[model samples]
Target: MKIGDLSLPEILKKTTATQGLCFDVGAFSIRLRSTHKNFIHTFHKLYRDFPVITDDQLIDFHIDMVIANNYRRWIKPQIIARIDGQQPFQAFAATHAMPLFEWALNWSIARLGQHYLMLHAAVLERHGKALILPALPGSGKSTLSAALAQRGWRFLSDEFCLVQPIHGQIVPIPRPTPLKNESIAVIRNFDARVFIGPLFEKTRKGTLGHLRAPTASVDCLKQTAAPAWIVFPQYQNQAEVLLEPLSKSAAFLKLASNSFNYTLLGATSFNLVKTIITNCDCYNLSYSNLDDVIAQLDVLSDNAQ
Candidate 1:
């Protein structure tokens, strides 16, 4: 049954208890347990559309977020992330539990999901054509991604561009887009309908919040689209939107450098990247205004016919 099928009271009862709760997210099933009241409340709201596991289903990642230790609980109070009973990262303040969960899950997928050539990019699709926006950190990738997803575009993923090599198709890995610092306000003011989670402050990424993916996106999780465009988006302050065509060689190099597992996949990665670029138009977009870039993308997608 869908998580929405259960009431808030029911979700809290299942998750806060010792047995934990399992939910199916696209191709992966996560069994998460957290007793922290605020964390549970946030989880229930952000993931309400996902289906909860009711039967005996195998869980891919068994995770937990809780206050660590008995003595330290009286002190500054820190939260720990346990994956299969092993804690790999250092603890953070208990207040930062939500962003911690989001980052930890991303770490799990980036490290263990070897089947797909994962890229550090935000992906979205329209009319069976996918756009891969790969960029370095602080390039305004997440901001642009959130704006697009809030608008008319289909949200695929904000952090990962999952590429299945054999078919040369982009897998849908839709999840809440993590908006950091200024991006938090940017999206909130940009889209009135956007359902943003609580502001998580003082994390390593500064003040953070999560924009839940559109309901339409979660319902179409089974659909996969081929890469039809590759745009490297960079947000600049007070600068006009600029969209420039990029060469295949340049695009391939940029994509390879930004991917999580490009070199690891060897020749298979090389062939797939080349094929994607060859079939798609590559562009370098620098924008300060969201509306201008959105309009430009509309024209670009329409001409892709």
Candidate 2:
């Protein structure tokens, strides 16, 4: 059953401040135990489309967010995120529970989910082919990916591009895309139908909010896509939209640098990266207009098909 199938009261009972809640996100199952009511409430809404698994199902990650035990719990409270009973990060203010949860889950996947070659990129699918957007921070990758999903492209992931090592297939791990600062406002203005959660002010990445993943993408979590195009996106103010063709050799090095476990996987990663670059078209995209960029991408997808 889906998380939305349960009422708020029922969710509280199952995810009691003590017992925790378990849900599936693409290939991984997570058991998150949090006492922060706001975080739980927001999670329930943002992840309403995801399946809720029974306690008997195998859980890949066990997470806990508990208020500090000292006097701080009452005076300017703080929260700690623990995975497998070990704290992997410094404590964050209790008010930032949602961001903390999102960050912790990302950490868990990047550090422990070594079965796949993980690239720090956003991925989406259309016509059975995947589009990989890999870029550094402030590159508008998340913004572009979220916009594409709204325009009917299936969202695979916003934070990670998980690729099956054996066959170079892109796996879907759709989660809430965190839109930081101005991007949140930009997305809200871009689409009237989009659902964004409440804003969390003064976080490390500046004031940020999460854009909910489309239900259609979450529903098709089992479907995987082969890489079709690799586009490195950058957003510049008032810049003309430009999509330049990139050489395969340059694409390989750039993609390899964007990966989380490229060095760890050694030759396996090398061969897989080569295979992906050789089969897919690559481009460098710079734009200030979201609509124009998306339209150009749509034309490319249509032409390919």
Give me the candidate number with maximum lDDT: 2
Q: How does model 2 score by TM-score?
A: 0.98
Question: Model 1: what TM-score?
Answer: 0.96
Looking at model 2, the pairs that clash are none
lDDT of 2 at 204: 84
Off by over 4 Å in 2: 17-19
Candidate 1 — which residues are off by over 4 angstroms?
17-19
Q: Write the per-residue lDDT of candidate 2 for residues 75-145, one digit (tens) a residue.
A: 88999999999998988998888899899999999888899999999999888889999999999999999
Q: Tell me the tens digit of each residue's lDDT in model 1 across 16-66.
A: 777788987775788888878878888888988887885368888888998
What's the TM-score of each model vs. the native?
Answer: 0.96, 0.98
Per-residue lDDT value at 110 in model 1:
81
Error of 1 at 26 (Å): 1.5
